[model samples]
Target: MKRILTAIVLIAIVVSLVLLGKLWMITLLAGAIAVLAALEYRTISAAMKSPVPMWWTIGAIALFFLAVFLRPQDTITAVVFSTLVLFAWNALATGVDRVLGETASGVLLLVYIAYPLTLLPQIWSLENGTALLLFLFLCVWCGDIAALYVGKNFGKRKLAPTLSPNKTWEGAIASVVAAVGFGMALIALGNWLSTNGSGYTRLHTSAPWWEYVLLAILLNIAAQFGDLLESALKRGAGVKDSGTLLPGHGGVLDRIDALLLAAPVLWFVWVVKEYFSLGSF
Candidate 1:
């Protein structure tokens, strides 16, 4: 428990510093994290006897880089084509490797790790990008913290006993509560800043409180799914904690599992709202 708390504090400090320092720093850090996560995914797939080709992994990483640095308008098409080609190539290589499940595994890896992560750069480049990113981080982090605390204290019904026995309905309730609190706090803070003429406000005044609430709820749900998704992967791979990449915390993948799922969902919602002129309500 002490170790977990200490790790959380250290992570918070590091994240705060990075967020305050430079935008490029955040991008670089996210890119490096994505690479590490991709490697972890590859390792898990290989261990599960899911044969992902070396060439496919390389190509996926290349696509990741292209998605991150290049603001190409055709990025979505490029990503789809790249993923398809990688899967097709893996299918072709099945004869050499004699693996039955390589195609499915390769496809999973590309979509789960690469495609969702591509949204990070897009979120960073939005008009209110920084606030949106911060909101994402908060939603995921708060959800996780709430789940942990509530699960420890009041967890009676297991949410998914097979994949993750530790998760519980009580934890899920706590997660939603925490998400709501965090969202409302952000709204209040934004309102305060806007009224005071402070520069820290990033959310638009036109954006409604209900939007934050909806976003928070969606983010919480996504975070839960993300954690479960990883749990399912780990169970299938017959391993624990992705890797021992972090001290006290399981691994980078474990720590950022919620963020991995929530980030893209948030970005997608924001994009859809913007495109359709939803008026932030």
Candidate 2:
């Protein structure tokens, strides 16, 4: 019950933000999430004996989101470069014994946690951005729910025993199926709205069905990997949940870990389709 309620509230908030279709608003929300996730990442890194500076990590993450919000084109190159420079300087200031571990963890905090999330607003700024954002959310959310139920009831063969003992191949397969099904349904609804002149112009109603299916598959795979990636991190850090920020969920990081990878995959596809004039997908 608690988990269901939390999921409902999160869905509502995300839908409201996407519907508003404002870049800054979405960036602001993403920024808050990034900060919280970074905080959790800091703790996890510390637990693994690779402690990164909390203030530096938070600052870099903030700058990453801000850069993406203000200048999407060169945000990654600029922010990541500056962040590395800071990490190098810090290494010089402190001792160099744990430099490799600390620096690597800092970089992971930026590239893994901060960079991919900045793509949310970028995805929103694309053509049919609102619909795209909602589609991404729906697919991931449906996959997560399906994986949970399927894994618990029918899971036998472990997917990755070292990283996450509970996950199973059965659950992973079900997640992909559920994500693709929900994605197609959403696309169908968009087609209906477009045909009926429902005033919902944020959807890409003309794309071929197969393209959307392929996208759903790609996103589902990415999301699954994202979940496994977080699980590996937690396992390495010797913790179960990332943090207790979200009741029945874990932490902001635990919740958005999938998006950490899934968002960038969508953004890359959007870029290729738009910038390269692919005209589809």
Candidate 3:
């Protein structure tokens, strides 16, 4: 019941913000999520004996979002160079033993968390951006739901017993199937809305059916790997769950772990499609 309620509230918040269709609002949502997830990540890092300074980490991430909002073309280069300089400077004030781990972990936080999230607003700027973003949310959410229920009931062959004992190959396949099925559902919903002359734009995507299916498969695969990646991190850190911020959902990081990678994959696909002038997504 707690999980269901959280999912409801979360979906409401996301739908509200995405429907507002403002770049700043989307950026604001992404920024807030990034900060919360970063804090949780700091906890995990500390447990692993590589603490990232909270204020410094947050400051860097703030700059990242700012660059993404203002000079998106330059955000990648800026993020890379700024992280290097920032961490290198920090090393000067720390002992060699702790400096390496701290610096490495700090860099990982930016790449793994901050950078990918910045793509949310950029995605919102794309053609049929609202639909695209919601499609992403739907696929990921459904995939997660399918994986949990299916894995719980029928999961037997271990996917990665060493990293995440609960995960199984059966659940992983179910996640992909669920994501693809939901992707088609959203596409059908969009078509129905269009045919009825409804004002709803959140479910529509101009991409062909085949393209969307291929894209859904890719996104689901990325999400699954993302789940594994976070699991590996937690396993290495000798902890379970990133934090207790969300009841029945662990922490912000745990919830957005799939988004961390899925967002980037979606964005990359958009970029490639646009660059090739294949079709408007």
Candidate 4:
């Protein structure tokens, strides 16, 4: 019940943001998510007795998202230097015994949890960015849901028993099929809406069915990898569910682990369109 209610509220919030279709709103949403996810990471680290400078880590993450909004090109440089600062901060703050481990944790969170999230804002600034962002969320959510249902009912072979015991090959297959189906549905809807009126102009896709299918498969694979990576981290830390902030969602990190990888991969495909001949479509 809690999970269902949480899902409903999240869907409403996401729909509202996407409907607003403002770049600033997307940036604000991404920035908030970065901070909340950082908090969840800090909580997990603290539970594992590997606490770092929470303020520095979270601040650097927030700054990275801000950089995405104000200056996209400088994000890499900013993350590099911020990582260095995080290393130095943790080394000096904590004893030498766990400096390397703790420092690595902070840096990893920046890359794994924080950086990829900022891509949503970047995607929002593109042509048809609103549609693209919505497509991303739809495909990911469909894949997640399909994977869970199919895996629970028909799973026989474990995909990664050590990292995530619940996942299975059947579920992975289901996720890919569902993602592709959802992508095609979005494309069809986008085309119809694109032709009908200019008012609904933000959501459009020119890619052919084959290319979109390939994209669906690619994103599902990336999302699954992100999920496994987070699961491994949690297992290593000897904890489950990064935090209890959400009623049934575990934490912001739990909700976004898949997006962390998929968003950047999807964004990369768009910005590098000439090479892939994506813009022609």
lDDT of each: 0.75, 0.85, 0.87, 0.82
Better candidate number, 2 or 4, judged by lDDT: 2
Give the poorly placed runs of model 1, Cα more than 4 Å off. 1-10, 13-23, 53-59, 76-100, 203-205
Model 2: runs farther than 4 Å from truth?
Answer: none
Q: What is the C-alpha lDDT profile of model 2 across 1-281, one tens digit per residue?
A: 88888989989988988886477888888888988999999889999888888778777877787777776687867676766776786678767778888888888888898888888887787667777888899789999889999999999989988888889999999999999999999888887777786776666556788998999999999999999999989988888898998879989999998888899899888878878788844
Query: Using alpha carbons, what is the TM-score of model 2?
Result: 0.94
| Model 1 lDDT tens row, 1-281 | 85588677866864574357465666666666777777777778878887566666766666665756665676666667766776666667556464347767776766787666667766766766656666777788888889999999989999999999999999998998898898678667767876786766555445777878888999989999999999999898887888777777776788778877898788788879879988542
Q: What TM-score would you give candidate 3 relative to the actual structure?
A: 0.95
The lDDT, on a scale of 0 to 1, for candidate 1 is 0.75
Candidate 4 stretches with Cα past 4 Å from truth are: 47-49, 197-199, 275-281
The alpha-carbon deviation from the true structure for residue 45 of candidate 1, after best TM-score superposition, in angstroms, is 0.7
Question: Mind giving the per-residue lDDT tens digits that candidate 3 earns over 79-157?
Answer: 7876776677667877778877888888899999998899888888887888888889877889999999999999999
Query: TM-scores for all candidates?
Result: 0.86, 0.94, 0.95, 0.93
Task: Provide the clashing-pair count of each candidate structure.
Answer: 0, 0, 0, 0
lDDT of model number 2: 0.85
